[model samples]
Target: MFDRRSFLGSAAVAGGLLPLPEALSAQALAPVPLPPPDLYGKNEDAYWAALRRQFLIPADVVNLNVGTVGSSPRPVLKAIFDGFEQTEQMTQAGSEDYPIWGYGSWDDYRKPFADFMGAQVDQMAILRNCTEANSYIANGFDMKAGDEVLISDEEHGSGEMPWMLRQRRYGMVVKKFAMPKPPKSPADILNRINDAITPRTKIFFVSHISTATGVVLPIKDIAALARSKGIVSAVDGAHAPGMMKVDLNDLGCDLYTGSMHKWLFATKGTGFLYLRDEAIMDRVWNTIATGGYDDPTRKADRYMQIGSSCIPTLMGLNAAVAFANAIGIDRIEKRNRMLADHIHAEMMKRGAESWTSPDPALRCAIATVNVPPVQRMELQDWLWKNHKVRIRGGNPSRLRLATPYFLSKSDIDRFLGLFDAFRKMKGVA
Candidate 1:
């Protein structure tokens, strides 16, 4: 219902050029409702079809690249647009009150997401993005020049680069452990991590889900191992929150960082840094300082003092959380795994070797495969330009397919069919 005319009209009004039509404005801001509860009991496929209507992605275009980013559903978009309208009016009861997000403890916005992530409001700091949170961990955590931070070899650039930058500038040691190409069990990963640790190991920083192969690491075991050794455990959970259920307390990690924009389908700039307690918080200096940056009484809120930021984005984040809650994360996770397993099985049948974990518990929505004798860039361009199908992968072979709950099995089938057609065309079938 978001038309070009209404968008332009709103922009014009913001510029003091013209008044927006009341009906158009109302239509633009209206919330998209979830499918009725009874629909799920009647026809599960139809229920998912109804839920799929909530997304703005065109019916013809299929997006399998949610690992890189996600399309926010209509309800979250509505909340952001509505928030901007309400906040831009600039009429406040308190003379000191402002619309910016980074100044004070905005418990109203923080508490809902905190509860969703299984953490207290005092332990969560609303940050701009996962990269910023990772940078904060690397640049702010107390470490001696020769101290080591052990990480997996398959970390995302954002997760790895910050530590690399720190190492280059401060002379800290960055250590790496190779992950099994397709780990058959949790012990395969755990043993590598254990062997990599030494006396100088100050931190065990790894991803909850591997960004490269889409493998879910054994985080609880990793956290326990770190705790036993008195090494700080930090997780780059950028892809975990919406893909599966996350409980920070249960995971028992000292620190965690993630982005809501990727899988949670929240606003683009929303992310968080979670500190377990005051002891961990004290070890990290504020990366971006303001008035309350050094205040211990503020708890995790003190880290959020990074000057002015967008409040409408946080509003969208809350709406995203509500949207997931309405559908129930358990149901969403099940659907995600089913779709991923389906795709993985189909790709295996096509002689594509699995890069994702063989263990179901070690893999979730993302299903990675290595298809040799076919150039990935060539196939990637062909699928997108010709078939309107989008996928992401590395050169030579690897394909990382992300299955959001919104995608139907038929969508995966279409991609599979296209893959067959492409292979046949190239004489690689």
Candidate 2:
């Protein structure tokens, strides 16, 4: 039985703050019904434009950097504020006197978020961020000193650092394989990864989508291969959950971790981890053990047993998932991809060479282009300073444009016009 008094004492208000919403019970704080999105609309732009209104983005700033982080929409913001008030109020009222009953636990957000990601409810954990989730998997797995781990050169630091740390601590061998700039096909990706695997390989670590090149790797095939080889597989999927359809069971990875804030437009510091086999929960040692560590019934949630977290952020994450659900993932995927494709075509017309793969199968909502005429940093600064258009420009000297569902075709067109002017200014031959 939960000690109601202890829970309330731990959750008390800080700095003489006002009480949060006392009605933190499931029934009292039930999610509000979202407005129906009209699927029958013929004007796609108009419909998308209306949807864009729900966000608090300034009219003058065009954000093509959702791949880095997304701005939470109005509904999610409202939920955060409401959750804060409710939690404080509940703490003030004391668990004995409060009308509602049950653990107003962060775990309440788990199932709905799990459903959103096409994962089992019992297999999910409310982690701090993608990095934390990845770290949990890296440190938890029992690997021998000489065990081998294979990963791509394109992986983000978060994906690579954990293995590197393990290598330093455990003498694990880490190998980096080269991936084609524009992959030939799915087989091509699979073959490259397969060719790299050796008898000593214990784990195959890769990204669902490479943030640098914005290329969608063949995660399903890779995961299946790992299972056949008796090797553990983990996917650094920080970009996939909301930007695309992420069916973890279908993907078949032993572990998959991602951030809700990136494409999901959830509050910052919200992320999750999905473990395919619930039994493996005990094998992976908890990095930070807390109350739920010893309970076998806790399942995958044992990884999330950190002491004291922001309750409102977890509630905000639920709202973010609800917001995305209202739009429908399939529809969101299509709209976002269409925008990226449009940008890809326009960049090609401007004599820009794409760093991202040309194959539709290998590319999704993120498009990276190398504009040779002007320096990438110069172009990025010009766009942000002159046009207030925010896109990512980084290593390998390429500009990454993230086509979110909220972005319109007109916005991409405007970006293209500015890009062309920059090319002309540079006197491209």
Candidate 3:
């Protein structure tokens, strides 16, 4: 299958560079034990059962917080290592192999990436990370000193940083839209955004899923409203790609960016950015200064990769998407929701309430359970120090559980059991 000579020839021509991980060894991994077939069934519950077979998770920890980061399967990880090893081997031999890009052309990655996102291939740009992707949109927009850019408090640092930098440096107006704690309805949330809008509002920036408190926005309606107001919509979907089913067309946003490493289970340092069309994206400067500035078609690639980067990661990143496609994104999504529902139900049974997301339809794989500010801080220390369950600690009386598709119901049950035990031990019960 791997015509080593042909691929090596191509790699030499592209750029004499080899990947990391030193190539496959003679010894291979032993057969992995899978979950019981019956545990995963017809619905989301069943899908979870099937999905758990794919992951190679450590037995000691209950990793319900895939919301923050996810692990790719053995195949993807192996590919990543192969890329590194190949590159390193070539380098050691006083030769170089292909560059960071796998396809002869950038469109090879774009088409499949766009297909996954439900966007036209031409509109998508593969980026290094979510920070780079969001910065491209944030700093690239055509704006004046007083031009209004509306953003939510719930946004990640990636969305908030660039605009904040722009406001101070360039004198742009950054408007903060206030969302209700427990939003009455999607309309109520929209009203908050609408109320902030004025004639000068040129940009509407929000996250499809918030990384901090885990609030999932109704981006479709919000995007539609932004369209009516002639505003450019940019979403920080760092938590959406692998955690949920994200169709860019359905969301109706002008621009969307997400991290592959965080949720897609791709290797670290890969991300995606989509511009509705080329015409709108021209506002951003091409990060590459050496070449391709004159060629409009090549601008996207040049912008995504500025200089020498980890090509091995890209190869593995590509394989990660292929794996996701093979498994079915919808099936992955349904199970993530089912797992979140499991966590939510169990937390409620233990007498803990939430300041987290409520709209089940909008929520993806993440859910936050607050155990009263003081209670959470102490319990959080206890869980990690005394107990082995790994989770994200919080400041706002919450613990965020970003369940990956691979985590099992029994795992969730175990986490619940821990919480209930913790509650009784802490005297909450």
Candidate 4:
């Protein structure tokens, strides 16, 4: 075990990623100092390295809660602001000159994005965040008071609210079931859903990855089962799109929603929703309409594409998707997992139990550590304010960590070092 005394005095913990580059020596690593909060424009890797460079985390402020949000990459940020400024300039140049809705604008966003996620261009729709994506289906569902919907405890408010909101107004019953602890097998989780599902169950809602638990659910199997039962399966894919492998068409779920901002590395407020050609096309009616809202059948498109968005961010999403594909999804997933495993291993070495999933197959780049006796906020403040290390945290009084594709094993080692230091300070045996 990575015992307490050894944890504090260990030379292994010396720098603790302070000059994270030291630990990154073995890899093609580049540690950037994070930009001062005031500045949000820079794309050069070296500039980015400096920006991500100094994280003063000391358990007092490790932001491990990435399920809620992720920091934008330097390039993505630069692209967004640059695009924003360019638009401002274009608008100043005059309306006719600044043709906003050319048939080409949204189409440029199509093929590349579809290629990245392994879906056909027409099947993917550029929507905002997971909430909006899922809501499209949730609000459009053809339901009656007697119908039932199945969801897991891991469902976020976005996934849960629409159903509940409908329940109050529509009288549909929202049945939430708990997933198996550690979710050892797909069958283990499916059985729970199977039990709660009755003839009344018309739809199944699942999170591709539970934001609350860093646990990756087996959507394929569950989705197949839902299909077998003649129920529609809609997935809350907020964490999966950017964090791991997701081919919407192949996954076979009825509908899917995702946030491009998280693992997708797109600018914030950009995301997409996908519908199986058979699942949503023409079956759901548009609840809202605006100008040119002639056909209620084609209204789903208008429902989502309403109001203008960050033109550059949406364009950059296409770029981010292309970048992810060029890098290879499997490669990024492997790198992210390796860093997470490193952190888990070191925490285990120190004899600290993980509050998150331990099974690698059931987990992802995100993980949470249970910190005994110490207040989470207190620990977070100390680590970030004193040690200069950065980690994410949230409720349940634990540390949640997400290793993006950009992180490496040495980065993991650095995090472990700080964890070791903290354990020692707490006098953990």
Candidate 5:
């Protein structure tokens, strides 16, 4: 058995990542410092408005599609650029640029990220995106041909598509449960999932928040129920980390995956996966073989070693975590929730409708509105061309509004005014 001491001992001497450049050799893999927070302001509104200035998003464009992809802030971009520049300037001194190998100390990066998500340093694996993380769990997880995996109907493609592939490859039975658009209550959600479980059910796979309608599932309740039945819980949390407070310890899932770019506002191609059970390392196989592939002691690191990928993006991800921490996760969540409420109320006043739930408990920053079927495509084009309001469209045939912490009330009002005017022009009641 790998004891705690031995696991940490291996971590201390573990091949953490690639070697550092000569200029950064003195500091080695030290965590990047966050910019000053003097301008964070005193009051809530002022504080949020001040935060808006840190991004490079153009004033002319109002991006309500943060759910689709988030734009990195100024500090994160700088970290990426600085790290990439340093990497490009490396020269071969003797045998190699700098000698450390086998995935060397991303501990500096990993520690901050772990703390942000309420996870242990050993349990986290920094990957490219949620898709890769989901794939790692789906492919690595040991399942027999007749085993069943329960999933929700509202999950994103990244979360459910992998399970489909797994079913085809391993003959694993995949079962789908109905997820209410605006869940009536936690009990209501649990009942549906509970009803779907069978003797062959081995895993409960669901999204923490639905990408289609922004319904925040009762993950802890769901996880607890899965635990009672001896089923593994795997959550796709692509939209959770930055938009809301995420405490992995409290969430109680066997596996979790998220994207840094979607809401954490990290540079593109940065994501992470968390595993609650260490024994899973032995059962789960790495999709890509690397230096630590065979070392069972490496645990999560085995999944993280994907050859020499974008280290700069990881650096930016570290910076992004620091940025969110400095802002305070609770404050960010409160702001986003408030923004979502504002949009929902305004849309209702304008005779607008939503496919997403308006209940505060069921929703967060995302709000998807139903557009008239005839004008759905036209509304998307008009919003982009005339108003420069970027949002997602489809599924229930609606506009998806994701309120980033940086966005102001004025920006939302501007979009609402344009949308209201368009409705009037189209002769919609």
Candidate 6:
């Protein structure tokens, strides 16, 4: 178990911040052990409950906002702390070897994540966050004046704004296709992309899973379509890495970027950019220039030459990948789908309009609904301040509920019950 005093004392020394509450401190300091392998076969519910102990969230609190960010679990935190302790000692075997990342290939850290994402180490570049990776795609990619980059209407600001910035500064064109509010099938989305493409379209850039409605786009089909037209395919997959099974080789996109911190439960500053091959790498210029940025022989490592960065964060990322592998991503994906399906169904029963897809293949982990007359901000505030339940949504209506594996069915039930009470309190049916 981590020492509570040490943790609290560090927080105090950092910024004179108030110490965590006793219950929260105890929860943070508690031992986190994985349940026995056989126990899952015997009692699945009990197995999940046991696994929940690994998280720092208090048992009484329900977190339905993992779409925004995830709390790092005990194992990841331990690895990060241990890394800091070992590296800060300033005792290296080699006289010139330093602890900082971003200079060398750092294959030990990059390979594990590359294997997890089904890519070779040469194709992966460990970046700071999804936004930086997106900027790399937008600003670094070779484009001429009036060369169009097509995207969807549902992209997050981080994904879309970079392109917008490029359009303002340079002379490139940015086009958008409106995604179906709730796509019933893959064809519904494919048709939109097909229609949106023009002769001048140089790049097909879109989100693998939309941040707005949590709808999973058909990336494989989109990539193929772009390939047939000789347009480069790039994806902003910020929410796809840990939320579902991602095989970049299978997806066959020219470029892909994602954040491990969102659903992967890794340290906050962990993200990556994947270039499909050397051909694509050659087309992209370096946004952050350093000594090795222009080195063709370095492959994907060339993109990682962005000054000095914390090595401990990469350690946390390795631990996160290990944790997910231990639990089995297939198992985690199933639980995510099951919980999301349950909540989506319950919301449908309550007459909420679905923003997420009805096709199970097009949705996972996140279930978005439009509950009109509910005042999303008001309900969000009421739930967190009064009920210890956390949620996120937009104005007037629209709830984007993210269901991670740690939550139980009863946790969903509690939220549903509270939803009824709140509706009644507001005199809405």
Regions of model 4 farther than 4 Å from truth: 1-65, 91-105, 292-300
Query: How would the candidate models be sorted by TM-score, starting from the highest?
Result: 6, 1, 2, 5, 3, 4
lDDT of 2 by residue, 82-200 (tens): 77667766664544534221222345688889988888888888788999998987887777888888999988888899889989988988898888876768887888888998988
For model 3, the stretches where C-alpha displacement exceeds 4 angstroms are 1-53, 89-97, 102-105, 287-290
Predicted model with the maximum TM-score: 6
Model 2 CA lDDT for position 64: 92
Q: Order the numbered candidates by lDDT, best leading.
A: 6, 1, 2, 5, 3, 4
Q: Write the per-residue lDDT of candidate 5 for residues 331-350, one digit (tens) a residue.
A: 78988999999998787676
RMSD to truth, every model: 2.9, 6.5, 6.2, 11.5, 9.5, 1.9
Q: So what's the TM-score on candidate 3?
A: 0.85
Query: What is each predicted model's overall lDDT from 0 to 1?
Result: 0.92, 0.81, 0.73, 0.67, 0.80, 0.92
Best model per lDDT? 6
**Lowest-lDDT window of 10 residues in candidate 2?**
97-106
TM-score of each: 0.95, 0.88, 0.85, 0.79, 0.87, 0.97
Query: Taking the candidates one at a time, how many backbone clashes does each contain?
Result: 0, 7, 21, 43, 5, 0
Which regions in candidate 1 have their CA more than 4 angstroms from the true location? 1-31
Write the residue-wise lDDT of candidate 3 on 309-406 in tens digits.
66677777777888778767886788778878778767766666654556676566777776773366666667777866777757756778877777
Task: Judge candidate 3 at residue 412 and give its lDDT.
Answer: 77
Model 1 residue 260 CA deviation in Å? 0.2
lDDT of candidate 4 over 274-369, digit per residue (tens):
777744666654454445333434322444545445577665676566656655688667766776777777766765557556678877887766
Residue range 284-400, candidate 6, lDDT tens digits:
999998998988999999999998999999999999999999988999999999999999999999999999999999999999999999999999999999999999977779999
Q: For model 1, state the Cα shift of residue 263 in Å.
A: 1.1
Give me the runs in candidate 5 sitting further than 4 Å from their true place: 1-43, 91-102
